[model samples]
Target chain A: MVKKEKDASTEQRILDAAKQVFVSKGMAGARMQDIADGAGINKAMLHYYFRSKEQLFEIIFRDSIGRFVPKVKALITSELSLYEKIEQFCDGYISMALENPYIPMFVLNELHKQPDAFVRKMFNNELPDLSKLVQQIDEEIKKGNIKPISPVQLIMNMMSLCVFPFLAKPIFSILMGLDELQFRNSIEQRKKAVPQFIMDSIKR
Target chain B: MVKKEKDASTEQRILDAAKQVFVSKGMAGARMQDIADGAGINKAMLHYYFRSKEQLFEIIFRDSIGRFVPKVKALITSELSLYEKIEQFCDGYISMALENPYIPMFVLNELHKQPDAFVRKMFNNELPDLSKLVQQIDEEIKKGNIKPISPVQLIMNMMSLCVFPFLAKPIFSILMGLDELQFRNSIEQRKKAVPQFIMDSIKR
Candidate 1:
């Protein structure tokens, strides 16, 4: 049991180190050696664990795609009203994005690079089932709670408002002439602002 | 004059081919040999026109950043009312993004890869002068044309709605169960939808 726990801990350490290296350097620039060094393990141990950089990258990529939209499916299907669900979703997602700013760009760029991998992952994994959300939207629209618009587009708009600020931080910061802290604070403001913006646009 | 004209044509051909290659493959994946082949020029002639791949990339990168926000400064300084300016800007920007869907991802990802290059380009190049735009927003707010909100946030929200869909296309497409044509159509729907969404949120 002790040995098994030690193995699991070591694997977790390697994963944590690999994520840091991958996030900073990207797939093209990242090296196995650097990941090993970051993990405080020898190259041989790294190889013994992951076999190849490609294997390691695939693991990370899958994990990233999976983690990017956690709780959205649950939140959408929850007992909350449409407005409450959207508020929670926007708030939760923006906060999550602030903590993991690299995930959006990293996942999207890698998807562009390797569509086949992403396609396979998508097929294998259970992504957010949007049909329920669509039904909810229909119910809300019928009940005159919100405007009639495509739920997909509405969700896309909300996600865009919440996430795009982080993805395009450099350009937005430069254009707005904001320093790092200022830019971060601006994004923090969007947690509330985005939900309100969406609700204003859609609410009846 | 014939010699100069021929040289100009050759350089233009090389640049066109290089843009195609670079836009598709990105800077790291691109090769001078492939670019030369695409241009139907020998490597020697490719070298004659551009000193190196790096030089070629810099030229394209600079041109891209400059072209991304062309006419923003001009539009802001134009005699149009704030509502008209925003309506035109949102319409024009969304249309442009739909046509050149790769621009947002390419610019933002490259900015992540090489901040120094992007910073120098942004500073040296004629990016949108936002001071005037902010002033215009203030004038409009005083006149009660739009609700009081940070001009920077308003601009960010506009851009986020227009561009983030393209940047996160892969994820959005998969999660929304949209194929390429469907995704493209949804984006087309947004050209009108986004402006209306913004107006609904901000307009008095």
Candidate 2:
């Protein structure tokens, strides 16, 4: 059991290192040697654990999705009122994006390269099922608590408003003439403002 | 004059081909040879037209900015009401993104690599001056035509909602269970829906 625990820890260390290298260099440009160097492991050990770069990348990509989707599921499934859910989701998602700014781009870039495989893998495994949330939105509309809007579009709006600013951070910062601190402040502002915007649009 | 016109035509041909290659392959993966072949020109002529792949890419990127921003300026500055502007902007931006589906990723990837240079160039050359739009928004707020909101935030929301689905097309499509036609239809839905959502949020 002790040996197994140590092996698991080492595997996680390798994964963490692989993520950094892969996110920066992308799949086509990433090298196993660099990942091994980042993890302070030898290439042979990397091969022993993951077999190949493609396998390692798949693991890393799945791990990335794991980090993002569970939080979404938790927030959407929680018993918070719809307004509160949007607020919490906006704050949580924006904070998450800020912390791991590269993951979205990494996922999107790989998806562009291998659309069928990545999309199937994500849909089958990591993308959260939002059926409950969709049903809840329908219920709310029926209750006359909110305006009629497609739940999918509403979710997409929340996501785009939360994520795209961070995704386009480099260009957006310069376009707005904002320094790093100001850019972050703008995001902080969105945490409250986005939910308010959505509530304003929806509340009957 | 005839010699100059021929040179200009060759230059344009090289640019058009380079945009195609660079947009599809990205900067790290694109080759001058591929671009030359696409243009139906020899490598020597390609070099004569644009000194290096880097120089050629910058031009292409700048040209891309040219295509998107002028339309933005035109829409924002036109004699349309604010509601009409939002509708037109959503329609125009989505159509532009569909037509050049790869440009956003190309621009974002290059911006990731050369943030300072790209940001400076965009700010200095291509970013539309939106002071008039901002003033109009403020005026609308003062006159109580819409709820009080920061013009910058409004612009950001409009951009995020309009651009992000296209930018994250592959993942979004799979996540939403949208095939190509369905995805296009969702965007078509947004042309009216987005402006209505915005109006609902802001209209007094």
Candidate 3:
């Protein structure tokens, strides 16, 4: 047998397989044996690269958080008006989620399971500083650009609108009897509709 | 040992234990033995009552859907204005969720796992008709009672705002560094704030 054990492609293949397994089954349900099978490697080899499932998840989660948090930081920190920010954020975030459909569930399920360790590791670098957004919202309220709403509440509202559908997509689709194409169409409409909904609610 | 089998209390006990096991571990990870232990019954007793985990989940799910869906149907079908409907929905739904925090995760997780069967059983009676709400929304738009918006979009928006908080509560609390009291307080404030937020956006 060819022993291409230490190669970059082999490592990438393992990561790809781990991402799929973790995304589908979540941390509690995932099995290392399944990951090894998905990666087409022996369990010994899977362990050789990553000591355990937790470690593998940490690496994958770090990669996901890195990509997700920075964009949010940039969106909030940019010198756009609150309305403009809402529009751009909804568009960017939804599009990002569409492209990487598994990330939200993967991060959230694990984060809920292990909040303290997950949050600490995710925010270790302090990349997406929320306080900056808070201050910006405060300035907007002071300037009469928007109605007085709690910055945290506004953040929560915006996030919940943009992300919840994806998080609960499978259930909503089945419950509402929406076929795949129809569900996607609603989301497509939401890119514009969500921003409008938020703006109308908050604009002075 | 005196056999006290096929009793009503024993059935209720098994049900309660099943709900807890299913909520925490989800269907894939839940075990029959755990439910038996939780109910303080032997495995044979549990099986004698429930036949299988799938059957147990079906019964529990039917009970959950019964309690939850009717309230929503009433909220929509009541002789209330759109504004009143939105207000009642946000307040009632939030309060319901706060009291039974486990149900959202329980239902959504199971529904996603088995979409077809779950939805079929949940709506077997053809309950909580969405069309009634959709018709009401159309009438409100015609009467200039609110801004023109798709009924489905509005329902999605309101639902996303109210329920996502509970669904993502544990993760949000940790991510935003909210303590228990703080999270509870936010939800408390949300009962009013969400309604106002929705009203402001759509009110003509």
True C-alpha contacts between chains kept, each model in order: 0.61, 0.54, 0.61
Interface Cα RMSD per model, in Å?
2.0, 2.3, 2.2
Candidate 1 per-residue C-alpha lDDT over A1-204 given as tens digits, one digit per residue, 9 for 90 to 100 = 144764457677788888887766677767788888888887887777788888988787667656645566678777787788888988988877787777766666677776656655644656666777778889999998888899888989888898888778877777678899999889898888888888888886
| B18-121 per-residue lDDT for model 1 (tens digits) | 87777655677567888999888888988898888889877876676566455666787788877777778877777777766666666776777766567556
What's each prediction's TM-score? 0.81, 0.75, 0.80
Which 10-residue window in model 3 chain A sums to the lowest lDDT? A1-10
TM-score: the better of candidates 1 and 3: 1
Instruction: Looking at model 1, give its docking quality level.
Output: medium
Ranking by lDDT: 3, 2, 1
Point out the worst 10-residue segment of candidate 3 chain B by lDDT.
Answer: B119-128
lDDT of 3 by residue, A43-125 (tens): 88877888887799888888766776767778888888777888999998888777777787776665555566766666674
lDDT of 1 at A39: 84
Instruction: Order the candidates by TM-score, highest first.
Output: 1, 3, 2
Better of 1 and 2 by TM-score: 1
Steric clash pairs (candidate 1): none
lDDT on C-alpha atoms for all candidate structures:
0.78, 0.80, 0.81
Q: Identify the superior model by DockQ, candidate 2 or candidate 3.
A: 3
lDDT of 2 by residue, B1-204 (tens): 245664458778888888788766678868888988988889998878677877888777776776667677678778788888888899888887777777878877767767878766765656656777888899999998999998878988998999888877777787778898988888778878888888899999
- For every model shown, the clashing-pair count is 0, 0, 0
